[model samples]
Target: MLNRSGNTKYQIKDAQQVYRQLSVSYEKIDSTSKKLVAFADKCPNIDENDISSKARYATLCRNIRMYAVQVLQNFSLSTRRVPTEDEIKQARDAKQRSDNELMEKVILSIPGINGKTLELSEELKPFIQQYYQVLQYMQQAKLAGRDDEVKLLESNLEELAQAMRVAHQN
Candidate 1:
């Protein structure tokens, strides 16, 4: 490759080496694609009325609990010191997405799930948003070294966690 100043810039010194690497990558991708398709095909379709299908729903609710309190557990500034803004943003997005996704998945996929559970999932969307906002506020308080505010928010988080359990159980 030539530079703008008419200087030689050795972009790819061994063209054959690049070709070999690409061929290896292509083979791996093809193998992985076939495996993924085979795995998906082997999984049985979930019917909401089927008792066996409740297993996945149980797993999903377990994940919801994990996501609900994920930030509070990770953002313990006292344990690990300050998290980067990027870390906070990613955590925040996950927390927000977690709540919203509960309703979406329940509504779209599990029609035979209890009607009350579906409605509760829908309501939990905004509740999940508020849960993380308090988390953000708690993060700010921790940074400010205002233990008072942080403690209060910790209690609030506990309450939110309880509500989350209630919602998921519904």
Candidate 2:
């Protein structure tokens, strides 16, 4: 029984060694990607088979590098640290500025607001006020454990802006 167990342990180690040998290294992948990109750039036209193959190889190399970086990042996630004072301050300042700009844009779109000529309906005033309130809440929420929520809000704001653009165009 002991002999079988010892053999099993050796087999596991050997498998790991083989796996590491086959896996791509970050530097090797980056070098290969650069070479492929150079080749692609030198090609006369993008429709050529050689250029296509080189582009595919370059994309593969980039994926390999990205996988390696993600693995490293996952390893670091286990020992993640809180942001330093400077980082926190910088993030806060950026959030404040972004929120200020967003507020200006939204208000300026309304008639009779921010020197804009479009008159807003009475029904829209409450919604606009609520929007500013939500923005204020998010600005203050940045200091709390709400970074992820703030990011969601920012994404939604982007979608809202796109919708507004479409509405205005129509």
What is each predicted model's overall lDDT from 0 to 1?
0.61, 0.57
| lDDT digits (tens) for residues 61-157 of candidate 2 | 5666667567655655663344556776899899978865665566675443332543444544445555566566667768786998888766655
| Residue 166 lDDT (model 1) | 70
Clashes of 2: 1
Candidate 1, superposed: residue stretches over 4 Å from native: 1-120
Q: What is the C-alpha RMSD of each candidate to the true structure, in Å?
A: 27.8, 22.9
What's model 1's TM-score? 0.31
How high is each candidate's TM-score? 0.31, 0.28
**Candidate 1, 46-152: lDDT as tens digits:** 56566655565555545545553453345333343345567768998998788567545533433233435455546666655666678789999999999999999
| Candidate number with greatest TM-score | 1
